[model samples]
Target: MSFVREDMNIVIVGHVDHGKSTIIGRLLADTNSLPEGKLEQVKERCRRNSKPFEYAFLLDALKDEQEQGITIDAARCFFKTDRRDYIIIDAPGHIEFLKNMVTGASRAEVALLVIDANEGIQENSRRHGYLLSMLGIKNVVVLINKMDLVDYSEEVFNKIVKEYTEFLNKIDVEPNQYIPVSGFFGENIVASSEKTPWYSGSSVLEVLDGFDKEKLPDDKPFRMPVQAVYKFTGDGDNRRIVAGTIETGRIKVGDEVVFYPSGKRNKINSIELFNAEIPESAGAGSAIGFTFDEQIYVKRGEVVTIAGQPKPKVGNRIKVNLFWLGRQSMVKGKEYLLKVGTAKVPVRIEEITKVIDASNLQNAVKESIDRHDVAECILIAQKPIAYDLAQDIAQTSRFVIVDNYEIAGGGIILKDLEDDSAWLRDKVILRNNKWENSNISREERAEKYGQKQALICITGQKDVGKKSIAKELERKLFNDGRIVYFLGISNVLYGVDADIKHTDNDSREEHLRRLSEVSNILVDSGAIPIVTAVELSKGDVEIIETAVDSDRIIKVWVGEEVTTDIEYDLHIPNYDSLEAAVSKVKTLLQDRGIIFKPF
Candidate 1:
């Protein structure tokens, strides 16, 4: 099937009364891009109001904006040239609507920053330029509007260009092109203006057509923030699907996918769609669902990724460059909700490294971020969330801060700070050192139980029968008069690892650390602790080895295919026969002297 040309999203931003809306209105009227009767309806309304028709009236669609004679919201309009389609976002220019401007600019891949030639440059003009840079829009065209009012003076345009270029350069933004135009008179918009003999650049429409569309990042790693888990079994349908829109890369049936934060790995049983033929594969921009081979618990806010691909970072603390639009200054200690992808978590401003004045490129140290202030700060979320760095994958890196149920700020994550478990590790160290001893020595308990204390971990891929094997081994040891107990990872999740979450790298590490402590206590009581985990990595085993003596820990892998980088004491190809698998594990335990053979 033939697809339409990719539409380019471009934003027009500038100071109030700088002709942002006027330029868009004139572009629509001149290019015959407006809908039938739209321009006439606007002009007719102005005539009935006993006011002269102005090009700006074509936009300012909101009644409040028309009455106030300003654009208060980002007005989006669709237009097309012979080259491609364009969605022009007319961002508000008023200082009060700076937040609206940011919302519009953040969606755009290219920008047109307007400045009045007569007024030279205004505060919002400089601020908008800086914000466009922070939003990662590199294709920018600066328009020197109202040139007719300045008598098309080349000198006036040059002076504004020189000053603004220097300001933008400081913010690491080099404008793509600069053009002099008169939006009210419709000169240098659709066609070149005869009035400006000195200006040699292309007209606004030509410059717009020259801007390239943002490429779809299907080549990158797959990323889909789980929107919902649907278990619609009302009509006796037994399908449970995980649904979300793919933000990048592609996925196919039978591909092993891993859910971030949770690290649950399962194979895609089938691609699910509504009233459509099942697709073998889907790429970026497809809103689809999938049924997994194994029934694993997956929740919304977890990022779905293909196995063996680069994983997203998971941490509670993040370094970001954000613009604050809250009425009150964003201060430290105040709680806010940070929304990234489908995840919303409570967050606080941990530190403000620098508060930037976008208008003049001035930097200052401040404890709070004032209204319309852009700052580099560290934010600490209540729970870890999965995200990519803006430099790597911009689609999943941007986030919004909601204050009092209002979107008060937006920004892109720069880096994931150190995991939240640094202090926890220290606490664990102190705990091990200061741990109390029982009246009966560990040697006495081992002699009484007639078995050596050991921690045996059964781990492999999902649905690999590690749990079944571990349980069977537990029963065999008990029947053989050995002191042994089976421990599932979920058992400690509610009691010991209850304070932290189950997902994310740091929380997962902390969870394993606590599990290690529990295993240590069980072993100290001279009982064999058999733990079953899913996809235990080398690092996970090391965490357990820290608490329990490495010599007393045994790792076993049970699967047809090995997916983790863990060296195991024994590898059972599959659990085709449960008793056979259990026998192999018991033999390994007996050979290792964890359990004594019949005397």
Candidate 2:
């Protein structure tokens, strides 16, 4: 019979020595999928060593695993049934290697959770079940292995099914089927076993074929995280192409796409391809590139979705269900790198709402997350990022936390928390959509003024010489034949804050919003708006960034000591001399390419 070549990735997970590897080996042997002479070679080696040959040894490829008689890594194997091919990922069953198991399981569409009938339910059995749910593998089958050891008793099998079913229900995971099988004796795997006559269910191989293949998310909204921006000017081909693999839905030529976080929208001009006919359309799983109708700056790591569809959440803070695996605990206020889709941004654990014990389904209050601890927590990113909720779009919601260059944790975003700048972000999106573009682009104006438009924010303590430094910087730039303006907070209070009473926190936020809006106008005019504010926090700058491009805003903290938690681009310690402070700021501008440097 001709079998379809379509493949599905499936993972086998359970407690250590519960026959996960042996079941995979049996599947290989029964399906005649093993390489020629591989099984015989293993049997010969076992004979020479005076040890009985076992199917588990077929998968224990690592020396450490063989010595310890346990899996240390996720081993992969391929096999085929009469219907389709299967890529079996034999994840390590040891508790210590739970990280490796999670890594393996996250890539699978289906999971086979093995539980030794003789050993009953173990710690890893429940933990693996919980992890399978967290990883979003909805297709599950419980393999009650080592049935021969339990004398193939229906009562024992039912008990295990009952206990495991209860545990799975707590985590909201329902197994597709619970089957009694013995991999060593090869009973109830490829064929039914008479020993378990009361148990009526399909064999392991039969159930595998019955599983539905995970379909591509083509039906969902179009979402593609920009992986790269390609420009091939070498062969007289000056097309600037934005390229990435589509995570969901479809995009066609002439379709309008909006990039998230920036909220920049543009129309597709043409689909670009390498030595082939450019297709009119592309769907999920296609690695495609397209040239836009306008030369809007699209950066790598920005998620692009078709306009008029559901928009993704754009914020700096998110609530997530995370599982930690770092050697050091995930502590609050410590910075780590959050990588979601192609975007990698600095992040910090803001709060741990509850830590869960996967084995017993217990919850605890914790300040830090230890290894293998699953927690529902809030994370604050250094800047805004775009993502969907895990329940909405699983692909875009999943993220990993990197600490000290090592993967420490992974999670799915449950929801985005409205940050301080959320209101400003909404206003900015509406403003951008309504604003008419000038024929003279910002780049053209930058060339004309010999400097890029920027907001050089002079921030520090109440008594610090922020105003003095701002005026000096403006004078220096003016002398250098550049367009510059010094905007004081007092300048806006009389005009913009004329009606609004500065009594509550809402008025304070509105003041900053008005200042940012004015600065946005100055920036668009290709002029530097040097503004001074007392003790500006990170949240203040974030609000300003909503109106202006964050990269165009240069934050300079002028003080003897930093009192607020603001990340500054340049820290001018003790602005004792106006010229000295202004010189330092000019040097920073030159280094940042905001101003042309001396030839």
Candidate 3:
């Protein structure tokens, strides 16, 4: 006879030598979860080696490579009571394997934070507590272990509890209870021990059974990041499937679906499963596939949402709370891969807002994040990714950073900052979503024109002779058999914006937006548009670049007064002579293959 039993993943996390493995070993032994002869086999090996047998040695024997009692990888032990089955994930305690710790701990719904009763709270004890809150696992049970060594003293347990409770409260984590237990002796673990007569609380086994079952919150809005767009044409399979695990909400057949970052829209034709009855609808946590009513260009990393539901924020820059575990410090300007959900993009630390040393939870005066440092920073990526703030949606908000093919850091986005080009990007995405393709492709246009389109924006201080240099460069490029058009600043102000009032700073921004919009169309028509704006900020350049292709835009500052935040590709200090300045600008273009490389 079979009975239904739910599953709960619980992680045992804390400092090294805190008896995490021993607790797991004892739990398995006392519960009769282990197969017969398993415990005796481990004892026999220990006797042959002339070593005192330990319950932790039962787990150690199963460890194929790592010698330390601390679990290097996320090791799972299965046990079942009359109620439910538990997956006790043994997570590493050392800082060296923090990435592995996060890997195990993040997946757990509830956590067991074990601390040595004798040694007291260590650095990793606090650090792991901080990270557990960040990982969104709030149901924690503080297991004060090794009471046998501490002589089962209530004073010792209470002192550690008082200290650790204060720290946890500081980090916004209130553990369920502080339980005293001896993993080695099995005191107060499976049963209430007389050694602690002053204590009256549930046993470790009781607490384990009492934790709630993890469930998919289907009431929330639907979100499914495209894991893979499958097309199995071989072996007589013609149906293309969109495969993924729904992170939230539910989806049904015939429901309109939208894929974001691309903004493609379609309807679900059918839910697909192999050798199982087809599901009419799938809810959050369901790993299934569906065929679309229409073939949209869906691919991996695009988030799927119900067409009428709330949309995820799309941006390239965001502020995050991250912990760096890399051997090398997480320095600015170095490229790292940011992986959130299935989406991966090249990222860099745009700014270090604050760095907090996790060991002491104190602000550290640092320029770059070191190993095991928790930091609040801003990250700028090459392209926009769809996500929600961690406060709004927990699952979609977390990400990890990879350096040199290793996971060096992990973070949760606290908030989405205003990307300079957010408004323009939204317009661009909507425009692209509804854009009608011409019979002639962009490739055909480039092939026919013998040149790809580009934008060359010349900017600097107010008194800088931007127009003279821009016109001269355009004339020179035009004379050199290159297609170029120089659009004057006055023309943009008057021709593009003859109606809008010249009121306040917003008008200037609107003027630039219109200028970029018009110039972008011309660039797409196989023409290099030379635009000159005085004292244009880097933010201004970013706004224009959002309207066009970033790779196709060239920024040049013509004067020494670099007032704006722009990182210009080329700078000419002396703007006295138009011809010389124009020649210098042309040299940059030639070097960049914008015009022509020197033969």
Candidate 4:
């Protein structure tokens, strides 16, 4: 495929009723990029509805959207100037549809944040600005719309521009251009408006025409998320090809690559896109496939990368900053689906550090994150997966949190807490020793208890039957004359002065923050062994394992089957009878060299 140098994506975003769609429609109309019949059809529909002709109606084609005069979803419109061919993404301006805005902005190389010159900056104006920053879109061009409403006065335009500029600066978005344009009047779009003669700046088209696409960061590390795998049988070739869009950097033939989380490495044999085996390399934005020398285990959502670059971390627990979009408030202890790149995984809010009040951009001590609130939170996924920080690479770093089929929030990974294993171990050991020494003399405890064993706690969804099996194992161990503390992790949190149940998203952080405190007490008590049951993901398991030093901890898997690198000392399948599970626990204890005595 021949590479097109002039291809660029641009998203238009702002507060609702700020003429985003109108501006896009005007641009397309002025540039004569719209198909011949499209505009006439839109005009006839407007006439039938008895509604006055609106430039926005040209793009707002959805039934509900036409009734409400609001853009609920991201809409795409294609156009071309003499300088470049552009794919314009019209993002929704409402705070309720911020997720849609993010979805649109994620695909664009540059963004045009539209603001009403008459109304000045609204809530979503600031919000869209913040979101663009979070989405890693640094090249912004502010469009001051509704210049006609303000009498096309230069003073009004300058004042609004100055105020909006200061606000953007506060959020760290340096706009490349601020154009004064009236989308409805078609002024200053393709040509300069006669009304604003004092405004000597270039027209919107001129600015877009002059944009330097070469300045975009294309030299980042190669990251191609496997969207799908193709295998052809009818064409006589029996080879499998991994296919996806190149998110960043470049990949060429014979380049050594690694599939993430799976940790499988292979060499690329050829790069193919639509019947062609390209010679050079594929840059960002190209959708292509490559066949590897060896048949490695490649799955959808797994990241493919060059050999020497820093690998994305594969972990269950992650720390992130989230922008909440759901109508209902976000609460802790609730499970949500996380979609990062192409992989969707079960996730929960382990903690909420702080909730940001969107109206004032100030920290609020709320119990949960409500609609339109931004928050800094820690999420715990059910399994280990590959991810990178947004700052390091936005392609792999950004993720969406989905609740009940709706995208409730969007976030970016600020940092990965997986590397704190060493510190966690030290804290666990120190706390364990402190409890052991404070509770009883070493000699006395040793004489009373034959051996000291660490506790492993598990927690997750209800109906998993965690408590039933925990009691049975405790009974078997106690009958064997071995001291075992079979405590419900929730009971330890509530009954033993530790807080664990998080009702809302804000309090969820407190719940996770208390996990370490409770675990320390159990480990230090010097019980022969401690076993508590809770539903937890592999990522959380790794975190707790590292926190308490897994070498001394024995994690037993119950219920569903999962893949883990941790050496599980015991694996018990879900049983129909309690006695059967108890018997298995007894056998496991015997295997571990514990003597069973009947009372």
TM-score of each: 0.71, 0.87, 0.75, 0.69
- Candidates sorted on lDDT, descending: 2, 1, 3, 4
Stretch of 10 with least lDDT, candidate 3: 435-444
Clashes of each: 2, 0, 0, 12
As a whole number from 0 to 100, the lDDT of residue 533 in candidate 3 is 86
User: Tens digits of per-residue lDDT for model 1 on 179-283?
Assistant: 999999998999999999999999999988887677777999999999998875577776779999999999999998877665567789999888999999998
Give the poorly placed runs of model 3, Cα more than 4 Å off.
1-3, 65-70, 234-237, 432-599
Report the Cα RMSD per candidate. 15.5, 3.6, 7.0, 13.3
Which pairs of residues collide in candidate 2?
none
> What does the lDDT come to for candidate 4?
0.74
Q: Relative to the unseen true structure, what is the C-alpha lDDT of residue 418 in candidate 4, on a scale of 0 to 100?
A: 57
Off by over 4 Å in 4: 1-5, 40-51, 61-65, 214-218, 230-238, 278-280, 419-599
lDDT per residue for candidate 4 within 161-198, as digits (tens), equals: 88877877776789999989999999889998897888
Model 1 RMSD in Å is 15.5
lDDT tens readout by residue for model 2, 399-505: 98999998788989999898877777778777765666676766679888888888999899977789988998899999999899999888898888888876666
Best TM-score among the predictions, by candidate number:
2
Name the best candidate (by lDDT): 2
